[model samples]
Target: MRKWLVRRALAVNVRVKILGIALGVAVFLGGATIVFLRGYLVRVWTEDLRVRAVEIARDNASRSTDFLLTNNLYELYALLRGAVDGNPDVRYAFVLGPDGAVLADTFGPAFPADLLSVSTVRVADDAEIALLQSGHSRLHDVAIPIYDGRVGTLRLAVSEDRMRAQIGEVVAHITLMTGLAAGFGIAAAFLLTYALTQPIAGLLHATEAVGREEFAHRVDVQTTDEFGALGESFNTMIERLGVVERQRTELLKRILTVQEEERSRIAHELHDHTGQELTALLYRVSVVAEAPTLEAARGELIELEKAAARALKEVRLLAFEMRPAALRDLGLAAALQHEARAFTQLYGFAVRCHVAGLGEVALDGESETAVYRIVREALMNTAHHAQANNASVLVQARNHTLVAIVEDDGVGYDADAVLAGPPETRFGLLGMTERARLIGASITFESSPGAGTTVYVEIPIGAGAAEGADDADSSPDSG
Candidate 1:
């Protein structure tokens, strides 16, 4: 049912409305005119028939009065018969005597018996006209007394067939006119509605194109109206979206390239550092196995132990680079402090770590890890490229948010240039941004050519904030 209704709604449009309204108006006006004209014509025709009947009856009665007074039944009957037979419009003409009996009739000796029983109406001067129905047809009867002192009535009936036929022809003509009006109305509606909806149709097409990812598709501005302005605005929006989409595409490519480079660096570090140490350890083992005396074996043993230790250290460093256990075992702050110390030792720089609210605010494990990685990456970027003497890492909860800021007083590159430039230079930044996004956080970089760089990350401590704080309070680190 819902689908059916949706289809019905979709089917409705400007063209249908215009045509329907045009046809509906035409029909309403035409029907009303037909009804009015039919009633008016019928009344006028009926009146004309009644007048004709009365006039014929009055004239015939005037001429036959003397005959009636002289008891001239032959002339009187002939006069009545002449009125009925001579006028096609007259169906019946009759004379009623003082006894209310039919004295003469055009129906001849076979005249209807019901005529004698017809109700009598007394009149003063003008003829009395009464409408009567006989079978399927209606008639107008005009009855007049022969004279003022006469005790007889002269009656004539005029069939309304001619009047009805005229009305029918007029009705036919009206129907034809109404049909013509509807056709013209529909045509005008088609033109008008099409003109109005053409712009909207273009906009719809543009929207569909946009949905299909055709961001270059634009609607034509046909006029200096609202629709034109809307079209212009829509085109502008699409153009901007196209730019953003291109930027995102480039950003994604850069992120992938950076990932490959990082993987290569890790492989290089493991192969060069750990492999050399293991090779040295194996050579030392062989030397120990081939020693001629205890003293010789003892020296090889010492070197073997040293090689093993160096190999183990390199392996540990690789493991730590992959994921530091401190992030999970101790907490985010401890992890940051450890990373800061490592960065300082590796880069020969002074690193400061300040963590407030980590012990006070309870954060979920994912949140802790995300914050830790974001800060670690920011510091690494600083150490690798900032060329700064010192850097600072701050992790705290403020204003209902967990905020981490990594800043270095160094010669910073343009943030916009790096972002809009090649992906290789900003892949790490994109990765950091993506990680922040994954944990429902926002990350931003504040930097200029010479103003240094500040990487800020904020994560909302929403539903899990209270639980995290409780967990922190119960832990040994929450002092």
Candidate 2:
């Protein structure tokens, strides 16, 4: 159940949540303030009423001294009645004799005999004030001793009903104002939340559209804040993703076309070279079978053996061209060195091989194949197109990375032109790139019109790096 509520809360709109929390906080603070103020105000007003009642009782005691000393009950009662008439808050006013007997009373004939006796309170001090319950109402009771306890005492009860009514009115006004302020605060919070979340909402919708392959969707907000910048960044990212998607589709199409072309080339080589050699060998064998003399048969058998050898060689060469067996048997380093020597012998170019740390570099089969292919393609491009003499293949390991660099002191073409040209013209380079990508490696070409071409292939050595680390450290510095 708690998880359900949490999920429900998370599902609420950001604007609604912001407003609700803000309004709730405001209402809580307002209610607390009103409660505290009401209590403080009530205390102040109640204390004021107590002080006033004491003052009035003291004054009346002084005024009724003569009446009390002369033993005139009627005059004392008139004074008490007049005091009660003047002060509307005074609920009951009376005089108490020195012996604790009621003498003059404002209630006259209706005064209870136990009125003074039932609630009699003696204080050591001359005058003492207190709040007490009287019948059905709460009263502020004040008693003042006449002549410092030599004569009767004056007592007064002030009703707190009026004070309570006033306090209630004040609190009602405060409560109403608090409620109105809370309402206004809620509205303000809503507006503020809307302003803050507008850009975020636009970004959300734009992302959803982009997820649906609508790469052109952009956030519509135009503010100059962080959200605006974020929206702009999001749009730029989507545009880049669209470009990459198109490039990926084009790359795949070109790769398929290249695969088909490679198959056709392989078929043509087998049919033209191997098939012709085998046919010639069969014809020579027929000649040997039809020979009338032993000498002629022997000569024809020798020719037939040569033709068979040629056909076997052609078939082996075709298989090697399809996938080099040297790469699998001799490892990446030895295979590269063999290819370099072969390339030098065939093309009459001075191709040098430099290998470092590869003796301990444990590369997976796929990675070795990829590196070998990249180097072979780079060298082939140099021999066919560079038209210069010196070329070098350097393979080494550095900082957990297997780095292979092929450099040629030959006339270089614009690297960017090859990269941007049609796939047919750049098929070899494209194959190298795709091969490097499959092994999670990167290939970079550095060249210009007059400068020499350099191709660098960097492969990450994730595991078994420590085995190569010592060899790499101990190896001599590379030029």
Q: For residue 234, give model 2's deviation from the true position in Å.
A: 3.4
lDDT of 1 by residue, 1-479 (tens): 99999899678987786777888888998899999999999888876777677789889988878877887888988998888889988888888877677777788669777655555443436577666789978877777887752658788888988678889998999889888877887888888787778888988999999899898898988888887888899999989888767657877777677689989988898789988888898899999999999999999999999899999988887887777877767777777888777877778777788877655345788778788878888888888889988888877775678888889998999998887776556767877887888899999999997788999988888544433432121111211
- Quote the positional error of residue 162 for candidate 2 in Å: 3.1
Q: Among all windows of ten consecutive residues in candidate 2, which has the lowest summed lDDT?
A: 470-479
- What is the TM-score of candidate 1? 0.72
- Per-residue CA lDDT of model 2 for 137-187, tens digit only, reads 788778899988688889888998888888899999999998888888888
Number of residue pairs clashing in candidate 1, backbone atoms closer than 3 angstroms, sequence gap of 3 or more or interchain: 2
- Residue-pair clashes per candidate: 2, 0
| Native-referenced Cα lDDT, model 1 | 0.80
Q: What is the C-alpha lDDT of each candidate?
A: 0.80, 0.82
Model 1, residue pairs in steric clash: 362-468, 362-469
- Where model 1 places Cα greater than 4 Å from the true spot, the runs are 1-137, 144-149, 158-181, 188-212, 220-241, 359-370, 384-387, 398-400, 412-429, 466-479
